[model samples]
Target: MDGQPTADVVDQVKDIPIYRTSVERGHFPILEKPEIADGFPDNWMTPRLAAALAAGEAEFVLSTGTNHARMQIIRPPYFLLNSYYKLWSEHPDISATWEAGCQRVSLTTVLATEHVARVNAKKRGGEPEAVPPLDDRRLDARTLYLNLRLDPALWERDDVVRMLAEIRTAQQAHPRGWYHLDCSGYHLAHLVQKARAWGLWEDFPQPASIIHAYEYTPLNVRRHLREHFTCPVVDLFGSTELGYLYYSDRHGHYRPYLDEMSVELVPVAPGSRIHSLIVSSVRNPYMPLIRYRSGDCARTLDGSPDPEKISRFCGREKELLATPHGPVAQADLDDRIADASPRVFLHQLHVTAGEAVLHHTTFDGEPLDPRACAVLERELRGLTGLRSRIEHREHIPVGKSGKYAWLVQDR
Candidate 1:
């Protein structure tokens, strides 16, 4: 790692077994999950790390594996949570709300909700309850988890009523009747649509600030959120292993939050606008990953490798699709679909041997007009160089991870 500007990191890890070879060779290759797991804690054990563990200042935890395989990692207690709070308190658009003692209500995945319930149950020496108490779902003094179903589309009236009642309770707890909303953009959208349909929208408390940080949010979904909410709709791009790296402002432009970290963008292929995200972060003291491939991809404002110029955290590099024109990213296709019609909501591209089919559902439960469908087909054909068609459905299902997959290939 010679010539790397992060000299402090080099000094810190130069003696660690996993990084010794790279340090000696003056070249650090991208660190993969398997390599980190092969040796485990023994490879990373140093006097400082051992002492931290002994003092209960650090502990081992597993990544959520939302986008990839789960992996064990070490960090201080509540490391990721503190990082999020710091950003929220400092963000220009939402700082006032954060300082005003606004409580947070998270609505994302059933996996997350279940994880919390199970942990609380274990602490209480009891079996996991199907409907845990509200205090059990509270992560801390301020944050609460609210979703209990894998698919928001399957949320019955009772489910919606319970969640809205919780939101009302949270709102009442605040002196100003304001609370912050943290959610998966898709999940929040489904909740809004269902609340309106069931005449329960009046019961739902309006949020002072909204953040969708769970996964990749489609363009049309974001637009839908803006149409329904008057507050800021921000997107945070990061992972469980790495704390937040970038966040969008109220205007939807990304700004870097690399405090003790640096990033390098390597093209997925020659002559491609999409680049793989290789991160070197010392944010987690127990494990400082060097040149870690985060499995994510992005594009720059002017197609440069400069990290500050990053415009979009498109999608996972593994999800990029090959095309005659070049590689196409999720954002690449989303831009076209949004242009064809803003009504298009959740969409997945199913590519087979000779043709590509777009399966989609709309916010209003209706298919696109004939002209809009034709325009979408033409745009997709030009982008992928394949026969393309649109198939509208009333509903689309989420994956086991409680997130949607934008691409599915049968070839």
Candidate 2:
């Protein structure tokens, strides 16, 4: 488990105790969550890093652990956020938002619970503060603002009334102010959907630009944002351990923005188009992950595992559903649903030993017709070779992280 990256890229850490006594430079063995957790701080800790941690100079970043094993990584302060800012400032689509003097506002999935807490506190006319401390630093003269977080549980009747009131309050502070919507959480899409339902769409300000990172955004959510807002919707691919490595253009095509990192796409299985992302990053001063399997899965253009031709990041590697035909990924389900109809907003596939049930909702606020539902059920059976049932619901459940899962194994 104590394997050092063999890649020459980690030459800087060659003398470090953790790296010096471990595996060769080019042969980076997969670093599993269990292995990381088993050792915790001792395995990767060095004298300098240990001192920094004791002095509060380094911080622990918790993994969302939505679909993967939960783990924590220690790094310097603002390491991940600063890295994202750099990537954002460099991207052509996002740079325009910065130039327009719009600040970045994050309302993504992870902020949901905290967002709800703050909103409820404010409802009682109390001052609410942010947890994890907002990085209020300026990037290119534009401030990066972290507003209240959003949790899906609050999307219910009683709380949503308060949620809307809170959202309107935030919106009024910057009406038509051209702010960048940094939707790192689940709020924006749900906010838009619910606001429209409650006849309060006009109260929310139009974003100057939209940046989606930190979570897997459903196609329906993307469609809703694009149709309602005229701003550019950019998707970024990265994690807390690594900075923003790739970004989607206005056309939704991902292009590399690796600052000081390199990547290799290795197939999860032989002849499989889905490849696990193995990244080598010495970008973080306190931590360097070399040839590290990121636990995220992706596919390449033309169905080959070429790093340069990677087309789409499918989903988490551990979530790949085993089928008689082969492994079916989240992207496979997404493709099938979109082919059936673009109206399908959110979906969750619960795979049990006997059957798989698809709980889904459409954008029109109505259940899918019998024909469309049958088509989707058949598609699931064809791909997964499992008895499939389609539950056309008015609403699908969201995880506490405020993210939706395309596939879930019944435990």
Candidate 3:
């Protein structure tokens, strides 16, 4: 089946309003953004779902959509928050690392000024975080989220000082002085680097557990944290559309947490090890996605396109680079850089017709050698069939949400 859902699966979501056409057609094609977003509530609404929303049984969540258009989706109230807590509180290996009732703090991408204020309001009984608070069946605790949004240049700004102070306060205010750091890995790395620069490393709290769910954590960031901190650094792999489906273990190996979803991987090109992730999820009761091209890519352990052997959720599919030879993914470029030097902390590939420029920085804050640069350029040219140039930088810029893009095209 190669991960594609059989026609019988259509019966699963047979009643969903949006799937009526596909159900009639008898062949469910891959769902795309336009169909998912346009006409939204009406396109997806069913009488039962409408009653759920109107009666406060369901709610809406917004997606950050770092690389594409933002989206709004209907979901069970507190769906993501509850799902996250369930994953943590249920895992024996991960749960023991923290106190039974330790508070959870989210300093990741979802934390922003307005969102923090709203959450605080809910805690104060001034507003409600979720309807009926899920009858208090959901986890109840004050979540200390960041009020400031992350940006590429946040570390260099004066406002970040207050953010650092806020984080310190959150840590110290805890009775045990150890709480979970629910953060984006990139954002956490930025915080640590900035803390070191400001001489605040001594005051920085050591988290009992770390959860990085917002985005992909590069190998360099993971290695740095594992080397310095003696805590479990967990990486949750999933999307806003689908709650986390996989998580990394202590050894950095991903294990499936698939609840109501099936996944398949199709090769990026003929004989290529890399494959695009296609997901069929009926996890969300309000909306279901079938044969959805997640725009995420991965590779198998033994160079075969097998779902069970999937190794890493490597990179995005839309960002693939077209060269004279063939298409190359962000992971391919990242692998080349990693093979070239251990000191390379971050990199971005900017490409134009027949040429490419690499903006990269080293961990030691030193410039990459011209000889080493030439060697990598030669390698990239050989692999991509384009002239490549390396530009050593003190830091490569990140997106507004503090996520780095490995590839940026000029043309």
What are the Cα lDDT values of the candidates?
Answer: 0.90, 0.70, 0.73
Worst 10 residues of 3 by lDDT: 130-139
Show where candidate 2 strays beyond 4 Å: 1-8, 23-26, 54-56, 110-176, 184-186
lDDT of 1 by residue, 39-124 (tens): 89888888898999999899888888876788999898888889899999999899888999999999999898887888778778
Q: Summarize candidate 3's per-residue lDDT along 1-411 as a digit string, tens digits.
A: 645566656777888877888788877777877788888888888888889999989888776678667789888876777667778876555786444455566666533434545655666688644422212212345466652454633556454565565556656766776667787776777677776777777767787788888776777777777776788888888877788777778778877777788887788788777788888988887877888887888877897767778778877778788776677877677667777776677778888876888888776678878777877898788767878888888767677655778777877
Superposed model 3: Cα runs more than 4 Å off: 2-9, 110-114, 118-142, 147-149, 156-165, 168-176
Per-model C-alpha RMSD? 1.5, 4.9, 4.5
Worst 10 residues of 1 by lDDT: 1-10
The numbered model that scores best in lDDT is: 1
TM-scores for the candidates: 0.97, 0.84, 0.87
How many clashes does each candidate structure show, in the order listed? Answer: 0, 14, 0
Order of candidates by lDDT, top first? 1, 3, 2
Error of 2 at 168 (Å): 6.9
Q: Model 2: per-residue lDDT, tens digit, 1-411?
A: 233344566566665455554555444565556766666777777777788888978877776676676678888876767877777777887786555555555565545335444545555686555553332212223433333334553465444455444444444446455567777434576767777777777666677778888777666667677888887898999987887888888777889877778787877877788888888778876677766788888888888756677778888888888877677778888888888877887788988998999988776778888889889989988987889998877766667555677777874
